[model samples]
Target: MGELARALTRHGIRVRVVAAHSPGLPVYGKIGDIEIVRPRYWWPERLEMLRREVGGLPVVWRKYPLARVQILSFFLMHAFVTARYAQSCDVVHAQWTLSAGAACLGRWVHRCPVLVTVYGSDILQVPRHPIGAWLTWLVLSCCDRITAVSHALQKRVVQLGVSPERVLVVPIGVDVTKFLPADDVHRENLILFVGSLIERKGVRYLLEAMPQILSVFPEYRLVIAGDGPEIISLKQRAVELGISRQVDFVGFQSQDNVRVLMQRARVVVLPSLEEGMGAVLVEAMACGTPVVASRVDGIQDVVTEEVGVLVSPANPMELAEGIRTVLFDPIRWREYSYNARLRAVKYYNWDIIVPRFIQIYQSLVG
Candidate 1:
């Protein structure tokens, strides 16, 4: 969302981001020239209500009800807020499909054009629920222009009945200056994985491959950065496989820290079963880290032979072999590292991607 907002702002569009359910009191801030309006709920009272409602339900039931209630509440609140603020803008650009619903309401009340972008989960994952499917369809149908992160996602939206012409594929861009190749001496024996520890993310496969990875390269270490419910399970798996000593779970790290880790790592791995556009892959490539990822839609788009290796998903032996192929061979590794940064600069840099979005926005507003 930040990336898109930044891109639109670069085109001389005045962007004001209004976020719902963000922590703390409402903040009006700036990232570069873009204005961000993050409004926090009055927590003590809201927390009390949430506690009462959430305390009794089983875990699975609790998630659905809580999520539904939150979405409805956010839509209501955002409608009120955006209707007022949206008056000054020509178009109300929503970052997500749910946000598109809010923007649609605001657009009707304010008579503004509504544009929405559907990242992977909003269409692929969220719409699995009956209510979610209906709401998603409504938002997709109502929006003036719909943007997707990949061609695969564009097709998915079309299947959802959004017009083929309405869907645009505008991938997120990377910041080249902030993420560049580290000094050769600084890169070490670290194998980094940066993302949530979830089943869909294939962290489990990475864990399963560790025994093979460590057997051949015992000196190398696997660094898992990010947090989720699966953290404890992944830790247990490491222990069960007797490769706990070779693994390091570093929870969540800031973008700077993630960039540093990417720069230092010998290789980056993301074995996701599905992805919209693996933003982290572009980030790692920008830092000259060769990636070994599954040949899923988004991963395939990012990991070309020049940049990194793509292997079959859910296969530990194949994943391990790919990682070893990169780590063991210095000539191939250095070539990929150079190519990764080059690819990031050429294709994934903000300079190139931001403008494409600007042209889209301009065409819509004009």
Candidate 2:
């Protein structure tokens, strides 16, 4: 959201980010030319702060009636306040179904067109429930324009009864200059995985592939980055597989650290069961690293033979083979690396993507 705000501002459009008030952030702040506001949603600010940190609302939602009321209260307050504030805006652009649900109500007041962007789980998980389905459809039916980050998501929105004409596929782009290839390649025999250590990411399958990967080349090491609910279980799995020593768990690193790791690895692997667009894959490619990812959903759209190898999801042997294909052969690695960087620079750079967004905003605001 921060990146989008900054990008929009750079293109000469002002953006105000209205979101839940977290513990550390100020109620109001500024980033570049963008304004950020986080209004209070509940009483006893400390409890709200704790809920933001540890997901306290969900804990109480299962048993407490007041917690259920708080959820509705939060949503209602957000919708009312957002519409009130957005009355003077040219357009209301909301990202994800929940935010769209809130922003869609702006039509009742300001009568501005709302651009609802469906990304990943909002379109995937939200529509599966009865209430969530109604809420999502309410936003989709009310919004003036709709955008998704992937073709897969665009199709899903259409399946949900949204008109095809209202939808656009405008992927989130990477900063090519910030994540550019290294001046000199010092890549090790390392296979890097950057994402939350969750089951959906297929991290366990990747760990299962390690023994076979190590058998081919003893020097090869696996570095898993990112923190999530599955991190502890993943560590236990590594120990059970007896490849714990070869695997390094560097929990959640910054984007800059990720860029360095991508450039320094022989291959970046993502064996996800599902994906929206796999922006992480593009980021790795931008750093001149070849990918070994699953051929599932939108991940297939990003990885190709020119940049990386694609294997079926949940197949450790195939993933191991794909990793071997990149890391074991220096000639092929160089070729894939060159092609990856070329593709990233040519297509997925922010320089190329921001203009597309500008065009969309102009058409809507006009």
Which candidate number maximizes lDDT?
A: 2
lDDT tens digits by residue: candidate 1, 17-117: 88754444345777787767754433443441222321111222344555435545656777777787888877787888867888788776777888887
Instruction: Give one digit per residue, the lDDT tens place, for model 2 in 92-127.
Output: 888777667788765689677788877677777667
TM-score of each: 0.92, 0.92
Instruction: Please provide the root mean square deviation of candidate 1 (C-alpha atoms, Å).
Output: 3.5
Off by over 4 Å in 2: 49-70
Clashes (backbone N, CA, C under 3 Å), per candidate, total: 0, 0
**Candidate 2: minimum summed lDDT over ten consecutive residues — where?**
49-58
Q: In candidate 2, how many Å is residue 318 off?
A: 1.2
Taking all chains together, the TM-score of candidate 1 against the true structure is 0.92
- Native-vs-model 2 lDDT? 0.82
